[model samples]
Target: MKHVLKNALLLFGALFALALAGCGSSVTDKSQKTASLAAASAEFPNADLLVSADSVQKSLNATDLLIIDARAASAYATGHLPGAINLQHSAFWAKGRGLKDTDTVAAQLGAAGITRQQKIVIYDNTTASWGAAGRLFWMLEYLGCTDVHILDGGWDKWSADGRPTQRAAVTRAAATFTPSVQGSLKATSARIAGRLYDNDFAVIDTRTDEEYLGWQLYGETRGGHIPRSVNLPYAWYYNTDKSTLRYQQLKTMLESRGITPDKEVTAYCTAGIRSGYAYFLLRLMGYQKCSNYDASIWDWADNTSYPMDQAPNYADAVYPAWVKALIDYHKPGSTSAAPPQYSYDRNHKYLIFETQWGSFDDMAHGWADNSYLLGHIPGAIHSNSDVYENGNPRWFLLPDAGLKTALGSMGITPDTTVVVYSDSNIFAARLWWILKYAGVTDVRFMNGGIQGWQAAGYPTETTINTPVATTYAGATKPALLASTTYVESVYNQPTAKMVDVRSGSEYSGMISGYGYVVNKGRIPGATWAYNADDSAGIYVDADATLRSYEEVKSLWSNLGIDFSKETIFYCGSGYRSALAYLYAHLMGYTNIRNYSDGWEGWSTNYVEDPAYLATPAVPGSTDGWRQDPSGRPVATGGL
Candidate 1:
C-alpha cells in the first residue's frame, strides 16, 4: 500500500509538471495586450498541428489559445502537456450519464477560461484514436467556438519528441468568458423526429453497419437504425484501422450515397456522441449544411410514434442489389438485424409462476404440460426474463415512455397487478426493476417465480390471450430517480450503501475507451458484489416466492455487506444490480434504491452535487476538500 501510494504521488506530480510546461507563458504574456481572455469576439488563431511540445510552448504565449486535455482524469493526472485543463469528453458531453444539459457544459467551459475567441487545442494520450478528443472538439464547435484544433498524434508524439514536462499542477490566473447561445448547431429529438422520412435531408447513421441495420447494440437492446437512415458509420469517415481519413476519398464515398457537400446532411447513432465526430469532419471539410442528432437513435427508437422501417432480419432477408455493391466495394459481409427490443410498461400487473427445468425451454415445456397450462392464474402473462433484456456487456435502460406504450398495447391496464414467476424470480427481478423505473409502483417479483408456483400446482396457459389497451397515468416522482445530485449526497453521507454488481475491474475503473469514466474506482464507501453469486438457490418452493429473510441475511453475511444499511444498487446502467434490488425487496428491504444512472452516469460525469451524497463531506479528501478525489487545484503548476 505504501509503495502504491508513493508511486501514485510521483505519477501525479509528473503529470502536473507536464501540463504546466505545455501551456508556456503566452497566456501570461502581457505583450499580447490587444486580445482579452474574457471576450467572445477576441481574435483566435487556427492551427491544425498542435502535437509538437515546443510548438505548443510557443503557441501558449498568445493568450488567445485554450489548451484542453482530452483524456481520462487518471491519465491527465499522471502526465499531460502544460497549461491544459482536463476537458474530458465523457464528463463534458455524453447525455443521460449526466453532463448532457447545455447550460451545465457552458458553465464548465466558463470555469476553464475558455472563450469563443480563444483557439482551443485538444489532444489525447492515444496515437490516433480521437474518440473523446474529437467529440469535445465537435461540442466546442457546436457551442460556437470557431477556432479549435486537434493535436495530431496527441501526447504520444510530444513525449516521443522529448518535450519539457513538469511534476506539478498548472495554475492559471482566472479570466471571465461570456458565451452566446446558438441553437442552430444543436439538433433536438423533435427535430430529428420531424426529418426521419423527409427526403430533403439525408439521414446518416454513424454506428456500425450492423447497428445501423438494427442488429444488436452494445449487447443490450436489439433493432436496427432509424427506418430509412443510411449506414455511414462514423468509422467510415476514417481509414480501415480508424486512424485518419482520406478526406477526398471519404467525400466521394459519401457523395455516391447521396450526401453532397451542398445538401443538408444529418447524422445519428446510439446516443449521438459518435455522430458528433461526423458533424466535426463535415465542418472540417467545408460542408455548409450538416447537423448531428444529439439524442440519436436511442431516443428516436424509444419514441414509438417515430416511424422506422424494420431492419431486414439478417436471418431471413437477402442482401439488396444496391447495398451488396457497397458491401463488396468496401468489405464483404451482410449487416445483421438487431433482436427485438422488448418494450416494458408499469401498467400491467403480471404474475409469473416458476417451475423446475434444467433449461429455459424445458421449464417452458414443463409449464406447457402442467394442468396450469389448461388455465393460468387469472390475468397472468408468461414471459422469460432472458427475452426481455440482453444480459452481457451493459444492459441499456429501457425508455420509460416506450415501456408504458408497449405495455398498454399488450392489453395490460395501468393498475393491473403483475406477478412474474420463474423457478426463482432471479431472472424476473429485471422486470421488477424495469417496472419501478418506468413508474409502475405496484409491482412484485414472485419470490421463487415459477418454481414456487409449480410446487403449488398452479395451472398454466398454452394459449395466448389478447386484452384491450387501457390508459395508465403513471406518477412522475423524479426524486426517486438517480441524478448527479442524489448520487453525491448518498455517497457522502454513508446513509445508503451503494452496491455495485459489476466486476471489480469495472468497479475499480480500469476501462480505456470513449465514455471511459473518471475517479478510477467505485464510489468511495460502496459495497461490491456480483448478481450471479446468490441467484441459483433463491427459489426452492412456490411459497419460496417471497425472498427468504434468512437467505438475504446469509448472502449479505457471506459477502461481508450490511443489508440493514439504506441500499442503493447500481451496475453499468442499473441492469445487473436490479437483480440485487429485487432480491433485497423480496427479503423485505424497504428503503433500497437503485441508481439508474449507476457508474455509467456517475463516473462519466462527476459526483459533486450535494443531493447525490447523504453526508456533508467525503471520507478521504485532503484537508477535507470538496473537489473530486482525483482532482487537484488547477494552479499547482503554472506555465
Candidate 2:
C-alpha cells in the first residue's frame, strides 16, 4: 500500500507541473522549497526559466526557437526582437478571463506556426505592459508546453542593455498544434470557494490597495477583496521605473507575506490580468503548489453570497475612480480623483464646488504650479469664498440677496446635492457653512482635499469648468447663524453650550491664532471643545481625512461640552468654527450654530487686560497678530 501511494503521489506531481485547475495541488520537499523562497538559493531554483538578453540574442538564429513579443502591435511596429513575431497580448485571452475557448486558442497557435512542443520565448514591455509576457508564459505552460520561458525583466531590460530590435514582423510555416488542456492549472470558482477556509491554502489578491480595501474599480456587484486573502499588489514585483526585481529581492519581500512553498496558492485580481503575472512569479520562484484564478472577482463578485471583506457602506464617501465614473457624464466632463454611499451616479444630481479664497489667478500666486492646490476635482466648478463675503475687511457674510446671486451663478439650487472641497478642511467647511447659511440643504464636504484625492491614485484638472446658472429659491435658514447679540443672549443661558474651537493660546488670551485678529482670549461662557488652531492637526488623520464622528464626540465630551443643548461654535473669524460646526451637523446634533462674528467681534466689547496694554504691541510674523491696547473689550481666560 505504501508503494502504491508513493507512485500515485509522483504521478500527481507531474500532472500539477503541467496543469492548474484552480486549487490543484503539487508538492516538493517542503524544507528545500521554503529555503529556496527565502534567498537561501545562490540562484533562483528555476533560473533557467528567465532567459537573459544575451542568451536570447545568441539563440536568435536557431531553427527550433521562437521569439514572441507579447506587447501591443502598436509598440511592436516601432521595434521588437530580431526575428520575433508581433502577437498582441489580448490574443492570449478574450477581453477578460473566462471568455476564452481552449480549442480556439489551440487553432490560433497552429495558425501562428506554434506546435505544442515548440521552444517558445515571450517578452513584454515590463514598464508599461503589466506583465504581458508572464501572462503568455503561464498560458503556454498550462497547455502542456514542455519547455517555455520568459525574458527576464522583459523588453525594458533588453532596451536598456542596448540590444538590437527590428520593426518588421516575422512569419513561419503553419504547424499542427495539439491541445492537452491542464485542468488542474486553472482555478475554478468552486475550487476557490472550497479552499477559502482551508488552513493549508493561501489566496493572494494582486490588485491595488484601494480595490482590496473597498474602492470598487470594475462593475463588481460589491466592492472589497476575497475573505482571508493576503494583499500583494502586482506592481510591487517591479521597481518604480518599471525594471523587474531580481528573484532574491522578490523572494525576500514576499517571505513576510507567508507565500511559502508549503501552501497551495491561488492568485487573483479584478479579472486575472495581473494575477496571471502572479502565477508566473510563483512558478519562477520554483513553487510548484500554485494555480491562477483566471475568472477571479469578475465571476466571484457577481455572486452576493461569495462573502467579501471590507465592502464599503452606503454613507461612505466616493473615491478618485468614482470621480472618473461621473466625469464621464460631462462633455468637458470631470476631473480625476477617485467614490462612497452617497451614490455618485449620473442619476444623482450633484453640484460640485472647488471652493477657494480667491479666483484661480489669485490662488496661483500662492500655489504657483502645485497641482494639488491649483487643480480642481473632475466635474467641479471653481467658487471663490471672496465672492460670497461682504467687503467688511474681516470676511463678514454677505447679505441674503448677494448670497443667492453668488450661489445661483454656480448652478447651486437649495435642493442640489452639493460637495465642496478646498486646500484644507477649514476652507471646505467655510463653503459648507456658507451654502447652508444661504439655505442650501444637503451640502457635503470632502475633507481630504485635492492632495488626498491625488494620493488615492485619482486625477485633478487644470481646465476650468463652466457652470450653468440656476435660479436658487429657498427660505433662508436664519437660525443656523449666530449674530453677536444672539450669541450673547443664548451663550450664558443654560439652554446653549458655547464651543470654543480655537487654539489653547487663543483660548487663554496669550495670542490670537489669526493674522488679522489683534485680540486674544476665549468667548465668555465658552468651553475649549476643539483645540485645532488652523484646523489640520489632532482632529485630522495622517491620511488627511477628518476624524470620525465617534472620535470627535468623545474628544468633545472629555472637554465637558454638552450634547443635549444648542451648541454654538466659535473661532478667530468663524472659519475654524465652521469646520467644528459641520462635524456636529454630520454627527446629527440637531441644534448647532456658527458664530459668524467669532472672537474678532466678541473682543471689541471687553477692555484689554492691563498687563497686555502696558506691554508694547509687537507684530508676530508666525501668528501675524499684534495685541491692541485701543481699549477694546477683552474677555481673558475663560473656561
Each candidate structure's TM-score, on Cα atoms with residue i matched to residue i, is: 0.41, 0.54
The alpha-carbon lDDT assigned to residue 315 of candidate 2 equals 30
RMSD of each: 28.0, 14.8
Best by TM-score: 2
Q: Model 1: runs farther than 4 Å from truth?
A: 1-61, 93-101, 125-130, 156-175, 219-222, 239-243, 315-639
lDDT of 1 by residue, 1-639 (tens): 999999999999998867765644323444642322231111211223223344555555456667778877777788877667776666664542313666777777777667777777777764234356667776787777767766655666666655644445565555555556556666766776776567677777776534544455454234665655666645445442333454566566667566777667777777666776777666656677787776666666666776665333221111112122222233324353322232233222333332212233545666433433445443445443333233223234444565566555544454554444443333445556666665664454444344334433554455644446666567544543565468776775756677767655565556411143333456666666643323333422123333223344465777777756677777666545666665565445567777765665554433445655445354332221222533311111110
| lDDT, candidate 2, at 329 | 53
Best by lDDT: 2
**Residue-level lDDT tens digits of model 2 in 351-376:** 77877666667666763323334567
Report every candidate's CA lDDT.
0.53, 0.71
The regions of model 2 sitting more than 4 angstroms off are 1-59, 62-64, 73-79, 88-111, 115-119, 126-130, 152-163, 176-184, 208-223, 231-237, 246-263, 284-288, 302-305, 314-325, 332-369, 372-639
